[model samples]
Target: MDRRNIQVGDYMAVTSKLPNLVSSTTAIYNNTNCSEIMKTGNPKVEIFLITLLTCVFIFGTIFNSLAVWVFCFKMKKWTETRVFMMSLLFSDCCLLFTLPFRIYTTQHPWPLGDSWCNALLSVYFMNTYMGIAVITLISMDRYVAIKFPIKARTLRSPKKAALACGIIWLVYISIRLYLALGAKWRNGESCFRKDTVMPLKRALYFTVFGSCLPMVILIFCSTQIILTLKKKEKTSMNEEKDIKKSISIVKTNLAIFLFCFLPFSTGNIVRFVIESIGSDCSLIKLINDIYYAAQGLSDLNCCLDSICYYFVAKEFWEKASLFPRFKKQLIKDQTQESSI
Candidate 1:
């Protein structure tokens, strides 16, 4: 490499012209091809993502909001289970409120400065951990209810559940607050989606403490509950219908939990492994993409839970039957109109 007496302007020209000097024509062809492909295909992907995200946001926000409202106002009786359910609703709503941020980010560049981005990222991680905590609580609640109904009835109160959920929030916040504060805005992406060492470490921690550990607890508690139910059926010589109902509830709940969580956990695991390996195959990429889609759907389970609980909580349905005010009013209105 010989030093040249070339002027700064000449050097600048050469540097700027470097692209034109080497393979520039080929690069242009490739770029043009990419642009055409994107123009034709990218819109479909964008449209699909937009529609999917919109539905998720609408249903999750409405249902979780409704669940909170019902728990607060309509349901006078609050049990430990109800309290845990409310905690889940709160966690879901935290993410639900931020959906618009994500939607806007997908379409437009990030307008909110680093401060809002960091704050929302914190909320995103904090509530995600809280959701795991609530799910664990729900599983434990069911276990206690089935395994030691009498003891659960005595020791487990909504106040205790509320206190536990509060502690979970504090822990979740503490674990993530440092990272959130440390977030750098230079990435120009949603802080949550951006991959960084701190984020990866936090995600792995969540995979263990928030997902895997809770999953263990859930499985153990759910198994114990099922066993207890089985014993009750055998010992009491319970009615076939009662035994079937109990089994059905347990199966349905277990399925719901696993269905919503397993894919997300798998995705996290894949992420961890990929980060560790630092290379990926097409299959791995596909799995990751599927996991991302599945996780989005899993998050939507907050809305699905409204439907699940509406059906699963037979007691709720029975109570609704008792309060026929709306039903009777509609019937009366119909009769009056018929008379006319």
Candidate 2:
């Protein structure tokens, strides 16, 4: 009878431990599965991204600073172009302010805590979309100026441009502020490394409104402006050279806009789709690599915005040369030309 009692006690003890043992085993399996699924790191891609961002930081800073100086001090009159350019420059500067942190986080774990991370990310994304919005505005402004020259006088003015920019800033800032405040970060999670998938609805909204809509506006406005200029070129023989130059600038601007932004937007969509469909781990990793590279490319837009400032602005060269250094160079060039 004592032996039977002992055997029954042992069985009960073992049965009590079985649930814990099974749970422990399941936990181990899950950990192993996650380790296998998640990428450790990709050294090559990291190096490339670091290099690209570094170059963008350097060039974007110099160009944007120069542009700000030119627009603020050198250019005396406030025009529609000046207003839009200044707004775009401000957006670029905002993005540039966060680039150092972005580069740092790319290589090392974020040490700035969650609040700082969210703030920087908010500025980063807000300015990125702001840049897009201002560019679209510029294109639309150009189209209006070209398509309806008579109406453009009433339609395009510095005050009106300022109002438009203000609206964009208000909208984007409000949305970003909402998002930044509402974001919930997990414990031990580093910046830009959230484990939770973005909600499908939010992703769809951003992909459509943030990227696709602006791109479509850019295309439509650019096409209309180019066609209008071409028609003018046909009718006006004396200004053929100037019209051709304008067309070339328009094409180059459109090309730069697409080149810098398209890959990143496409990658976002592709990554979202892959994640939604439960793609393989390797495929997700590949998409991540591509997305990172595309993000690097997108950073180049700040540097390239200088191209638009120089070519698209009517008074850029004139105002730029007003600086003592450029003025001296201009004099020297004219002297050499006359001597030749």
Candidate 3:
């Protein structure tokens, strides 16, 4: 009877643990499957990304270099606009600096040491957010200058703009340093390729603050500026042409900003969803492709930013000697308020 009791107790214990064992096994299987799917390369997607990045690198380098020359050497007067343009240019250059390394890593494993890989990635992400923050600042500055010209006289200045940019740089640098110190590098890890798992908190924070907040601020400021400009146009007939030009420039800037950054933000959200739910191989592959394409699109921002420079800065058009036929007209249309 005692022996029977012992056997029954053992059977009950084993039965109680069965569900946990099965769950752990299933979890392992899912993780392994996801990793395998991510490791498998898609040649078409790879080729597309490589081609896109190469073009971006070439164009971005030339455009941003010209911007640097105009902003630094050609532009004589220091104003809030120049300060912001310089900040934006700095961020673009940083991103461009990482492109060659990124292009190389796309097809080949990172021959550089793990430290170099981490540093490059840190610079890339750091400047990406930095660029977004500076663009937001530019929009806010424009809105204030246009919406309330009197207050802008005191509120907006080159020194203040420089201070604001300094704060942005400091904040991003600190964040990157903290992340680098805390990050754990796995052996044989490839640059720009990591595990399928996304940290819930970090991803949420980045999506909300890094992308969503900037986008919202940009849209709001742009809408207010446009409406204000339209009202001004109605009140002042003599300035109608300038107002129309201003509206066109604002719309173009906003559209370019959205087009470049939207894909990467969307990919981030989708990746988070796929990770939260147990991995579907199809979804994994799709997300991987999205990521590749999105990265190329995001890098394209460095090139498109030149458009903003041309329209926003009077010196850019005047000193760069671009579009000579329209230079006089542009100089007239780009009044203090219109340029801002």
Candidate 4:
């Protein structure tokens, strides 16, 4: 029979294989606290989670697919914009790739082995961190482009974008590989790493690398872009164009940083702090659940990125038709110019 079909009582195989510490915890929870707290199952919560995740998965898959298609087939050259956009799509899709497992696991108990369980955890964290890194760079790219156009032209190139993306992924994956191999669920419960000390340490690393560093870079770049635009307000004729450019950069950074990432990271900071302060295990579990829920919210940003693209890049929006349509428009415009 499938693992999903198995009852709580039939959880023998998983429990039997677990280490004694885990087994003891499981038995204690099952006998004493499980009924009082867990209410036998979380089907309602699981249903809601599935519904939310399904929407996220479908939207993320579609938006990223379109972005990749446009980048590969429609776009002419590997410009800096295209390079950053391509990198974003790739990173976004990595999270989308794991959605099926996440969605399934919400309703069903973990179906896979220990290794697969750890792998899922690692992939989710790595992809999320990677995506944040790329978005940060994209904001910086925009800041340079608008604030210092000539300097931007020299610094912003597809090769550099690709190299930066490669480095981000490599560093993220390297730091997280220990999670995949060393991390394990307690009592076969399919959680993160078993060692208690590592959670606080990992959380500190996460705060610095994934959250703090990116936020600093993003804020500095965005602030510069905003200030430079304000300084150029003396040019009354081009004021609208300049404002739009400034707003584009600011909005992109604001959306990803505020709406997508900040909540979860903040919660994580609290979680780590609580762990460091030696909070009760039950409170830690509650906070962790909140963190995961916040993470679900963050994942939706990948799908919503098309909205950012639309608002930020009006040129792309205006000219985004088939090649034949563009060719026809070009010829018509040329003919009109000749007649005039």
TM-score of each: 0.73, 0.84, 0.91, 0.76
lDDT of 1 by residue, 1-340 (tens): 1346457668898889877766778756654553333222134434655677789888887766666666676677776656777777778888877777766765565687888887887776677667777877877776776677679768678888889888888887776676766655335434334323212565677778788888889888877876776666343433544655666666676677788778888788776676466443343444444555656656666666775446444333433443676655533322110000
Model 2: how far residue 200 lies from native, Å: 5.3
Error of 4 at 108 (Å): 1.5
lDDT of 3 at 116: 93
Top TM-score hit:
3
Tens digits of per-residue lDDT for model 2, 1-340: 9999999999999999999999999867754564445435578987998899999999999999889888888889888888999999999999999888878877687787888888887888788878988999998988888888889889988999999999999998998788877765433545654343332455557767988899999999989888887776354553665677777788998999999989988988888888787666677777777887988898899999998987767566666775576765654322110000
Local distance difference test, each candidate: 0.64, 0.79, 0.83, 0.68
Which consecutive 10 residues in model 4 have the weakest lDDT in total? Answer: 331-340
The better candidate by TM-score, 1 or 4, is 4
lDDT value, residue 139 of candidate 2: 89
Better of 1 and 3 by lDDT: 3
TM-score of 3: 0.91
Assess candidate 3 and give its lDDT. Answer: 0.83
Residue pairs of candidate 1 with colliding backbone atoms: none
Give the Cα error of residue 52 in candidate 4, in Å.
Answer: 2.1
lDDT of 2: 0.79
> Which model is ahead, 2 or 3, in terms of TM-score?
3
